[model samples]
Target: MELKSWFYYLITHSVFNFRLLIDGLNEVPNNRDNLLDTIGLIAESFNKVKICCSSRRERLFEQILQHNPSLRLEDLNYEDIQKHCYRRLHTTRARRYAYLVTEELRNAVNNGDDEVVLKRRLGECPGEMHKLFTSLVERQDKFYAKDPKPYLRLIEVATKRGDNNNHGAGAFLTFFELLVASSAQEEFISRVPKSLDASLLASLDSQAPDLKANVVVRCANLAELVPNRSDLQSYPKEFAYKELVNADSLEVRFIHRRVQDFLTDSEEGAALLRSYNMTEQNAVIRLTIASVTRFLATPYMSRVGKSLKWESLIEAGFWAKNGTGALDIIFPTLQARKPLRMPPFTAEDTSINGKTPPFNVLCPQLSPLENVAFGFATGFAMVAYTEAKLRALDLQKWRLVVGFSSCLCVRAYGLGRESSGFLTMFEPYLSLTSLTQNLTLSYILEPFTDVDFWVFRHLSCVATPRPGFHQSRF
Candidate 1:
């Protein structure tokens, strides 16, 4: 009764129009009578208040609201449904017409037709998505008639897929990463310098936007440059170097997922690949080479120190893992670079480390390529172990070894061992390895006995040093 009085007072006091919407009133379990009374009150105050509600056609509600303005959804919505269907039908026809215009315009430009002639040829014609894509590809081929390999290669990289339809090496490449990858390709390598110095890096950074635009044009609009959300600020400041900032904050992706799907469909994709004379393996290898080249060019101290950059390191490892025989090609190059020296350990150093030096101190510095390889191996191992744990599956022996190895690597890199505690970091993997393998502590200690040996044997095949280069101690 008090609720009814309050609602009555509210409706009476309402000076302007009041609109209320109640959905699924039939779903209300209790207070059916009170709700009906509220509706009656709203009807009495109809001049100032308006209420629209939806409910099942119950007998009680029908008797009360039958005389008032009422609508039967089942009967009254037909006109609305017809209007929606008509709009969709018109939209489909309009899209077909638009596609026809695009196709005709491309042909006209290729034939060097005048604007007047092109305008006349813009009449509606039948077309489909597959036909439109084919037309676009053909236009690109004609545009690059002299040397379409680079154009084709970029397309192949953009659409490359892995086993089980997973994203391949070229997928979701950032603007800078794609530029580096393109430079490493066979056709473009001679044209663009492979090595990037500080000045060159800045120059490329400045020109990144224009480079991206050229890339998109070369790919015939199938690929596009998208903003990199990770690099963007929630509320960006208005500042100078805005162009450079925008370039850094962009990534390359297909304009739409549908474009990727259409291009990567098994039958259509194979035909396209054969037409371009491109292979997924070759594209991945190029990406791997680019990654390694970039990593080698960047200084080690710059990579790990205050000016740290993980892009090259992470990319090198990822591409190398995916590219068959990539390590063989990059290992020599890595060794050719200047070797890292191991710092001398002294009693004072040991005393400062509390009888035992930290892992980073013991391992010292690794060659750029070795650091990438180790980081990749350890990171991959941790991911696999985590997935296995989540799925409640049997932990593999190799995973245990690699997981333990990763803990050591984490410590060696000074990532989080000190603050998080060594035992806390190592205990889970150590305990799991013991429980699952039923191995004695002696066997567990054996792998760490010769860190270099196990790391080379299990984690990577690039452990063999060049004739003149001494391999860094792990």
Candidate 2:
């Protein structure tokens, strides 16, 4: 059967085809003459069937429907828009706060069509989805205006993940890491808009010479800021929606798909997000650097392995290498006194401090002799050279090893002919023995395995450790 004839057949001859509704006809496009002609054919062919077509105001559709009864839905849908905002607010993480604001908007907008009041109310409670999204962005901007680091950090994250419309929304965890990354002084300094000026950067550097000191505090503050709430709950109150969706997953997402689309697809929304002098290219560059930092620092090594495929890591590295300026800054050489250990997976690990220690524990007994020797021999010099040649991975972790090894090497080499120095010289072999003991569990796994394999290879070549120096991994 002909395509139109088939459509007509289904509409006219089928048991459930008495009514045919064609909607959103105005979205078809500028060259809509054929669409109008087709609609006219369908309408003209209908006798027993009832046709109801809904569309936005368009000249061609209006000309076709000149004599037919039609209704303008923009006004009617305005009320629906109110209901939608109300529903979205109540259904969201900040329901209590949203309800209060939405109620105020409802009362203000509904009280006798005063134009000025209506305009103000619209700003607060948008009468359209796009406007509602815009209003939300404005609200966040106002809220974060005083300390825009977090908000600016958010734009950097979302833009880096690609537009939600094109690549879909990123997981909350992804945003959280990027947010923490944005706080890195090296990364931020490299991309801080010239408009912010060198003076501001210098001032920030004076306070936060090392990014780690303030990174945790900044992350905590940002956690409270986004999916933003006006006031925080005194006690922890988990949202119902978060519970229904896997709340354990740190996936940052837009509240609604349309909201996502608006931010991604609308020029107005992009402008709002990039209102800062920073460009999208610059924002993404900072985000990539931040991500590499966050990944190294996070306690989710196992999770990282599971979540990030080899391709994903490669792609992440590629973007970082190409972002903003070409290779503006490398990951800072980490200084360490102790090796960072994985937190024990057990029930007793309940206390925040107990669950997450400031420094990771290392088994020097598990390192290879050559790796230990090289690490103690050259310190950061060799590690820096190796890092310069390698791709983006956990250069930070290797730096920690090198830093500690260098420190121990100094003490060992300084001891001269002491027995302790001799013992320390054989420490890597002893560590090797311990590693072989776990051969059944993990075949000849070196302590360097804790660092990324690709990174481990780079660091292992220059490896040397004598003994006895505190080591800390991110």
Candidate 3:
């Protein structure tokens, strides 16, 4: 569909349809370059938009601004906007595009494109296309005349943003910035006569209405802050959306790439998991073969393999240079480490220091306890990166890997030996094992697998930290 039609589709859709909303952005031209730009546009177009993202998405946005200079995408500062949401800002610009379908947009606007399809597609009200057209037709003169009705419409739309709690204010605030860029904000504010602004502010009787006054003025200021789009008409319809979509795509990929680390870690270090009965290292080989086979068989990550013919990539000697042998990502922990050996959690196991060392045991690949530790380690690294304000995915991902790997390597030197208290496991299973059924297993798994003692202690560490009483550091 054409971009305008897609806009209609977007504005008319529901929140749940957001994923499709993003996927549909590809219909625009120069999709990669303009994704963030279009995203900003979509945000402004809506009455209220709330946004959230995975950390990876935030870093993706950071990367785009740094590497792609001319695009000049703004860094959305989540810290400044925390007043709007309970969580960290992780949503990519894709989310903005997804959120533009506000109730007002969903209200009948007539572009006269596929009415039946529009209703079936929009799913909000019956004959939505006609209803939308009617609103635009009736309001065009008022809008062009700079009447207060437009401001009222904006206020009314803002009122309908039921989910004001979830950064609706913040995201819409960014959208206001988008409107500023689009010259829409200036138009919007200009339409609000001083009398209307005064009246609205005076009558800002409701909570949302009160927020509306502040948000509108801020939006107007933000709009005024943007550099003028000297040649908005020159902006290509097809290319605008494409540019915005592409910007978003880079961010999404940047995040999933982080996920790849854990998956690869699970597989490489996962001693027992077998895809189609392929064993350990050989299974990895087979996994690659099966990947190629599956790519040949169908199309999943088929882009890497390219073209339908299933040629053996192994023979291609990717690292040899026909294709790149270099890994897309590196896991420093995946090296040939000391053998997976752990001392049995015997009664003799006791700590040399009064306080047992965190861990000294050498655990097997992806042993449940080890997986739990790996989870903790990965999570800890992620938190550190956030605290450090590193926003690039590769930087965060690799940085975490480096830190976690270093921690692991040092522990591998002798981590599990210190504490047997952590290796303990659930006691109910002891009955199944006879010995374990009667009592909680002793000796934490530090060096030994299935030692019941240390497991719980390690878990306590992984559990969310107990909230401390607030005290002034000063």
TM-score of each: 0.41, 0.31, 0.15
Let me know the TM-score candidate 1 reaches against the reference structure.
0.41
- The lDDT of model 1 is 0.47
Clash count (model 2, backbone only): 31
Ranking, TM-score, top scorer first? 1, 2, 3
- The numbered model that scores best in lDDT is 1
Q: Per-residue lDDT for 355-404 in model 1, tens only? A: 32112312223333443334433433233222232234345543434343
Ranking by lDDT: 1, 2, 3
Which lDDT tens digits does candidate 2 get at residues 244-272? 11212233434444544665578866665
* Candidate 3 or 2, higher lDDT: 2
Kindly list the per-residue Cα lDDT of model 3 for residues 111-132, writing each as its tens digit: 3334455555455423333233
Cα displacement (Å) at residue 290, model 2: 3.8
Predictions in order: lDDT: 0.47, 0.41, 0.28
Q: Answer with 1 or 2, whichever has the higher lDDT.
A: 1
What candidate 1 gets wrong by more than 4 Å, as runs, is 1-121, 124-126, 141-143, 149-152, 155-171, 184-195, 199-210, 233-246, 266-272, 289-375, 381-474
